[model samples]
Target: MPKLKIEDLARIREQARRATLLREGAGRVKITVHLGTCGIAAGGRNIMTAVLREIEERNLHDVLVTTSGCAGLCSREPMMTVEVLGQPPVKYVDLTEGKVKEIFAEHIVGGKIADRYALAVGSERVM
Candidate 1:
């Protein structure tokens, strides 16, 4: 591996800071991509890439993107959950790159749930 450069370190530092902020719930929106084995087989990686691309293209700093394992809906592989502050979380299913972009634009940025793609809203009850 090549020696790490100052610029690379700065970039890494910025990424860590952003992650810290997300963990502390500082962002207005949080997008969690489901990346389980089934999800990966169904293109979850593409969905994640699409979400990140949308954020970068929009120059958005208030959106947090993370990944999780299976959501217990294997049939809904390539799923993602979008949680906007002050609103219930919405889980979208069977996602593709185009659908992910649409969800980012309409749900993540516009603050409107993309109902057509959404499988459900709100979280499951915990014991």
Candidate 2:
């Protein structure tokens, strides 16, 4: 294979920098995929893959993707929470790859919540 030129290295560096920024909370949106034991048993891995695929396909530099433990709802395993800056986070449950794609397009890209797949919008108030 031919050696990479300085320009190629620069482009790679920029891409890495943008990814770091997203992970550092500089992103406009954050998606947390629940991957607890229960979640995995319910196909959380697939959900995670779908999320990543969507981000890659769309080349979304402003979207951060992460994984988390259960959301205290085992039955709702394989779930995810989407948080858009300046708006409340929305929890979506019982997902499939197809559903994830739709959510990414409608909610993440279009700024509209996917109500059909959403479990709730925002967290419960603390006592």
- What TM-score would each prediction reach against the true structure? 0.80, 0.84
lDDT by residue for model 2 (39-87), tens: 9999999999999989989988999888998899999878999999999
Error of 2 at 63 (Å): 0.7
The deviation in Å at residue 52 for candidate 1 is 0.7
- Provide the overall lDDT of each model, using Cα atoms, as 2-decimal numbers: 0.88, 0.92
Predicted candidate 1 versus true structure: per-residue lDDT over 12-45, tens digit per residue? 8988876566567688888899999988999899
User: After superposing candidate 1, which stretches have Cα over 4 Å from the reference?
Assistant: 1-25
